[model samples]
Target: MALDGTGDERFYPGYDYTAPSGRSGGTLEVTETAACSASAPTDLAANATSPTQVDLTWTYDGTNNDYYTIYRGGTQIATNVTTGSYTDSTVAAGTAYSYTVRGHNNTGACDSADSNVANVTTPACTELTPSSISFNGVNTAAGDFSGASMVTPVDLMNLEFRVTEGTGGGAPFSQTDNFDANNFGNWIPSDTNTSNNWLLDANTTPSSNVGPSGDHTGGGYYAYTESSSGSYPETYWLTSNVLDGSTYALNLDFWWNMNTDTDLSCELHVDVSTDGGTNWTNSVWSRTNNPNSGDVWVNQNVDLSAYTSNNLEVRFRTISSSWRCDTALDDIVISGPARATEVERLAWNPDPQEASAILTNGNSYNLYARGTDPECGTVYYVGGTTTPGNSQAFTWSSCTETATLNAPTFSPTTTPITGPVTVTATGTATGIQVSWSEDGGATWSAWFANGATYTPTSCITGNVIFRAQGTGTCGTLTAQSAAAAFDTTDKDVATLTTTNPSPATGVVTIQTAVGVETAPATLTGVSVTIGGSSACNVTGAAMTWNGTTSRWEYSWDTSACGTSAAETTVTIDVTGTDPDCGTVVNAVQLTGVTIDNTCVDGTPSTITIAPGQTVGGTAVDLTTLFSTTGNVGSFTYKINGTTVTSPWDSSAYGTTGPQAVTFEVTGTDPDCGDIVGPVSNSITVNNALGTDAGVAGVASKNKQLDVTAP
Candidate 1:
């Protein structure tokens, strides 16, 4: 009210119109929250297929950051379901419920706005055919069969059954109350260790135990008897699909409290069908876990590996027990593609310098030579399943002037073995082809090859010689690498190549081969020495290769040999050594040395019959030749000219012959060094007197064990 430059604290009623300017201010009130929405379907699912359950898919997203505040008409149903769909499987059939969704983020405070209401009704079990199926023990007097015929699955697809037993007048199998739960079918058949033991009883109608259809149906009903006096079979099976190379389990309810069968092993077998319903095979490998209570629902799983396979029909061989038991079956599931290891790229070129790949894992695998190896084009050779998982990698070795995947070959040194033995062949190469025969290539094998990893599938085991061939059409078809023996008892022999200038810590390369012998010929006394002393360290060193002499010597004790072979029988001990390797002052940095023999002197025990010897042949008297009178331990011998490791304890030592005899002790001892002369000796022997005439004629032609390369 006041006005004009008059500074006063008093309120002038008359000068109120002369007010001054002021700043902006307003009310920021929070608005009232929206009401919670109604509930929606919580668990939504879709089973529009044969399953009799309701597949309900509902949503409750009326509001965000909230639960699916669901309601079933009169009452609140599901709450706090954040997913987009909900399946109400427990709904009643033919009856629909109006559903509305409201968001409630666990706050218990649902939205007030209800979702657009929709009604849904549950579906009824469509295939309502009540089924009854069971056994009618065997009949002896009729010499045939009697009792209720089997219930064949005319409706195999979309089929379900409930056991209804009685004096035969039956209703819908499931509705028959006298047959459920506590009760079971009568005259059950038990599987014996038999071919045909469980059959129908003698006194019933449907005299032919099988169904009118005339197929083999196990134990009929009502008129069957129990007989455990003979060795027979009773294991029954109802055809079903469980084999597809898929992981699956047999879900059944079994009750076998009174089991008396000893040769019984209850199993769920799945005979597989791979070819679109043409041929069928068994797919059951190892038996799964045992069946639960023989009468109660028990779930069992079995690896479907050992079963034969076909296209569609997979017979489920249920109980393997000979004792009368009961098992109810349900929901069998098949799942899993779990890959432990898979070779996605298996490409290789004959030329190591070119693009190539090798397998290092020592497991089994089949190398498929693809004409189009993504990068290598269609290769000619492919490998088969490799085993042991450790041979996953291979080397592109060099032979002569060309690169190869082969090991060093050798003629039997020290004691000469049979002639024309294969020393080495390509280890890992493209299109590896190999075959062997003692008949001078008169005939060859189902020769095979690997893609790139030149690991052999079939090994030359016996006296038969082997020759490997690798073809690289892009390059050329290389001749057989080396002739090796197969089906032999010879110890495998091989050489180890090291890194050129090694890691200064000694060289490292996989020892791919061992000399051919029946027993594994271990590389004993193998030591890596520097400066001409036994050492384990060779970390850093330099050496010069004399073009002519090809010899190397270390100047000083570069590094201590940390790597040593003193640990195992197979592993080679490499000394770790490091020092200024052959500098201007020291000269040579690294050198190669041959290890001394560490084979424990074999023992010569009492003479037993030898494998090959005639009654009149020179019996190389074991007592005279191998008597522990000298150096002897537990000894192992070799078949004349094979690399098969024969068991040490022979029931009989054959008569002496132009044959080799070598042996070794069980354990090593400092007191006992490598066996002297293998306690080994050789003598020629003739055939035994009382031999099979056919064997006498074709004894030399006895087939040898086939070699399978890995």
Candidate 2:
């Protein structure tokens, strides 16, 4: 179709070829639709403030008129909110929750796409006051508050904590100004209002300026209350007395209550002074607003350990921003660690510090100390054991020093002590000293170094018990030894006497009697010696109990001295002992113990025969040889240097000339086996009638004839 003309602006359909002038015209039309939609919200975030609540927020390009729809786990939980923030309170604790938000128009038809998913999990409940806790003091991870992952690691080391709780011992000074006493004057006021910090009136209604009806100091009559009339800053200073902070870990506790008619500013400031209140520094408990939750009184802990000085003071101040009920304070307590008292025990040995006290068995020991703190007063201690010989150091947890003492042991505990007994004390250590007590430990002897021997006065009479005491090296601590007993009254002292034989010429017999002064006792043994010679044979039996008459006899032959007549002194010595008594020795002497010679001779007379008389006269006799008093026996004779028979023949002396002849005698005795006498005789014979007689020869015939003639 076509057509176009100058003014007509018409077109004709069949004018293809130029059949032109004819044209057709009608109406022409065009149409389109409007687009209205929204984009997705961006940057979704979530926060779980508590176990059961999750707060969500998001960013979006939507207009102010658009609202929001929050979905949890792909399900809508809240809708049509004007703000981008939402709180879901229906969530469970320790559970993960997925959330998303979409911006939408008020018609709910035009809506943006869902925002990014926000995953959040509530944290588990943690206890504020745990039995123990370990904090590394480092935060090592980045995570949201609601994440379930651990943000840091914790380790526990061996640590000791001393939490002292008390009022007096820890602190050198404290004050509780309830106004009952004039102690309120302690709080010197340089400020304007003095009555603002006084005790609360009894039975008064609670106001901003006063305590509640039941509010009072702990276990006291009234509470210290602060009330102001106008907007004037009120300050009260309470400076503690001088305290030695260097020796203590100081702490304070107080009960406080805050109430305000209007929410006006109230404050409590704590400061420490090292120069006795001349200077001040803020303490850990200083607070501008009342830290207490409500009008009820609460306790708070404050530490002042940082100010460790010998001279220290603590100050408390109360100030207010306007005239309102400020704060109520009650029961202020101050404390610190107590100082340990110094003490020590002395060593058991005196000279060496490493020695132990020796104690006796079955005796109680009294432990004494010399060096101790007088502040703690006199310390009395006693310790004992049945077993002795111990280097024992006595220690007390409250004391600062330790010491030990040595014990002593007594010997000769045998019963019925007949003889003098000696007791000795010994110490386990070198320097330990000892003392003794005999009167049942009633009185003690002076201290003896090392050991000592003692014989008590009661040794012979009554039952006696001995005890020993040991002193330590420091001379402070002492230990007592166990008691030893010696008992019995039976004692014996022996005396000896000797008697010589009656006849001293024969065997000498000696007898000794050992007499006991005390009865009911026996002699152990006895020995005897005679004439300074131990060759004597002695025989005796030990005496029995109560048998004091015992004889010790000895027999010795006097002839054993020599086989000759001699005079000698005989002496006897005896020694004896008893179980209960000591040794007894005695000696006896005999002046004339004559050992007579067994052989003696009488004077011999000369014998003469007129002449041989044919050499046949009666035999001449010579038999006056020996004289013996004791131990005499057979005799022997010798003549002319030759042995002769009894009834001797003088013919052998001959009728010839003169013959020489000698005679001797010897005697034998049992005591003196053989003895020779000093008697000897010489004889000469004249042969007058014999051949030589008258002249030579002769023919004269007179001798031969006369030899037979007489």
Candidate 3:
């Protein structure tokens, strides 16, 4: 190639060098191509399809793009999308996000600007209705639903109920200590090493580079172990006050910080005790790794829901093997859900969202409702009710019937009756029916009408027991009366009358009438005795029954019972015996009874009289002048028809040479009547006193005259 003047020069291919200018010559050619362009997507929009998903859509203008790139809050979330719509399945529930879309062309190595920003919020978790529910037979009104709002369709609903036998249920149990007051509120500190126990530190630990620089509550006091105060391998423990977890699920939350030279040289352990801190066998949480260097405070939550005891205790234990490890603790809390004796998860249901439960009579209960959202993986409480004050409880009562039967009454109040017997009784009950039992309630008769009586046909020999039975819906009841006795022995003879045979002679008869006989008791025999003599006694067949007079008769021969002339008193004894009533006796006495026969039948045969006694002078005795041949009892004398003494006195017939005297004799006889004999005699009497001398002269003259007459 060669150049010549000041104007432009051109070089041709395959030419030699020019003489004036030395230059190389090459071929020069020009080629033309089309330009590639892509536009940004427009109208970018995002919609929440569910609690956890978001859908994005936009309009693309150029076809040169191979895919769309998605950005969320300035961060690329997806690429290589061939469609205008994209679904983000990684979004969180109840969260807001800003999205933008861009078009990209991998072949042209270019990208369009981002589309307009799309802001959207994912749907919140689902909630149930009725914040509280309560109902019984009497209170069936609807529940309160003012506290619940649903952001998503509920995937699952459950209604749960639990009966609490305990008396613990009300506000939740909460115990929090922020360590801001420079003292442990309810926390107690213990340690194996007395000098290196847990102590309250304000803002910083005593040793450098091993513990927190400040408390978790910002410059407040915190409990920490002092590593510099004691030997290596020291242990410290901080225990909380007793708590009640028997009725509710509980949680223990606290903030802690640990710094150590080695990763696992120091350790922190959370332990629970149900025996008042005597033992800590349950270690719920533990950490062996240390907080590298910053002494960062980490919040730790330990679930105490597995424990159910009134003496629950929580303690934090730190074991340090070297002085380079130190641990600090602050803002301790012990709390739980509302206190309930029990919590039950009911069966899963999606429709209606209602259920029923049966509660015990004396126990209390609590009702709770929960709903779940599958999209958001959330479970929340929507409704609840409690029975701490007996708001929802049940009591039981029973209904049944009962009847009582009283003892029966007999027609005859007295026992030992002879005729038919009647029984009556009263019962007390609702719709009661009565019956009778005669065999000590072993068997019963048919039901009787109200106020009815039961009577038997014939009397029984032994005692009879009566029972009254009553029946109703509840059951049958029976009552027994005192036993009624019947008489089997003979009846007593009340009265006895006799017809006396006074002045009884030969062939005498005795009659006796006994008292009227009562039924079931009859008289068996009758006996009679006369004059207290066994010879006159008659009994059994000797006495006969007289049907007309209803009397007993006996034949008594008076002649056989020794005769007596004088009237005599006699007693007739009548005895009657019944097979039922044993024996009875009746006696009648008869006075002036003359029983005579032929025993004394003769009279006196002779009588003699003595001559002379003067009147008004010495009396003469004539007691032995009469004689009888048969049993003479006495003699009677009379002179000239005048009754005289035994000896007849002739003094009353003063002038008479022949005075008349009469005598009579009576014979003693039992079989015959009295026998009488009469005799008469004459006696001569001289004139008395002036005749003493004349009697002497007359006696001399009678002798002389007897001599002269011879």
| Poorest 10 consecutive residues by lDDT, candidate 3 | 701-710
What shift in Å separates residue 629 of candidate 2 from its native position after superposition? 99
For model 3, how does the per-residue alpha-carbon lDDT over 1-710 read when each residue is reduced to its tens digit? Answer: 55564345555555664535553455433232323354567688899998878999887554778888887644477998888899998776776566777788766677776676676877886544312222312111111111111111123434332223334466666778987898989999988877778888886666766787888747688988877756667778888888887766789877777656445467788889998989786457876542232356665668898888889888888888777667888889887765654443223233332222333322333333344444463544432221122223322112133545566676766667565555666767433344554443345577665445555424235445455555534444445555466654444544567776766667787887666555212455566766643234343434677777566788887665544343355566676664444645453544344454434344422332322322322354445433344433455666556667744444554433433333333333332434343444433344444332111111111111000000
Model 1, global lDDT: 0.31
Query: Which ranges of candidate 2 are over 4 A from the true structure?
Result: 1-182, 185-190, 194-210, 214-219, 223-225, 290-292, 339-710
lDDT of 2 by residue, 476-592 (tens): 333444444444443555566666564455575456665665532355566554453223333443322223344555556665553454544545456666445354445454444
Error of 2 at 16 (Å): 80
Please give the lDDT score for candidate 2: 0.47
Per-residue alpha-carbon lDDT of candidate 1 for residues 1-710, written as tens digits (9 for 90 to 100): 43343343344333444434552344323334544343434443333322223343554354544555555432355765667666554343333344545555445354544444444443443334322211111111011111111111111222221111112211111111112222223212334344433343312222222111111122322211132333333455444432333221212221112111221344444455556436656644223222221111122344443333423344444443433322223333333222223343333322122211232222223221111111111111212111111111212222222334442233442122333333445544466554544443345455544321222223233323344545332232233322343332223332323333332333332121212222222233223333333554343344332334323223332134433332121222232211112111122223443323233345432222222221222222333222333333444444343332322223234323232343321211223443322322333233344332111111232222221111
User: Candidate 3, TM-score vs. the true structure?
Assistant: 0.31
Candidates sorted by lDDT, best first: 3, 2, 1
Candidate 3 lDDT at 132 equals: 26
- Per-candidate TM equals 0.15, 0.25, 0.31
Model 2: residue 484 alpha-carbon error in angstroms:
40
Prediction 1 TM-score vs. true:
0.15
Count backbone clashes in candidate 3: 11
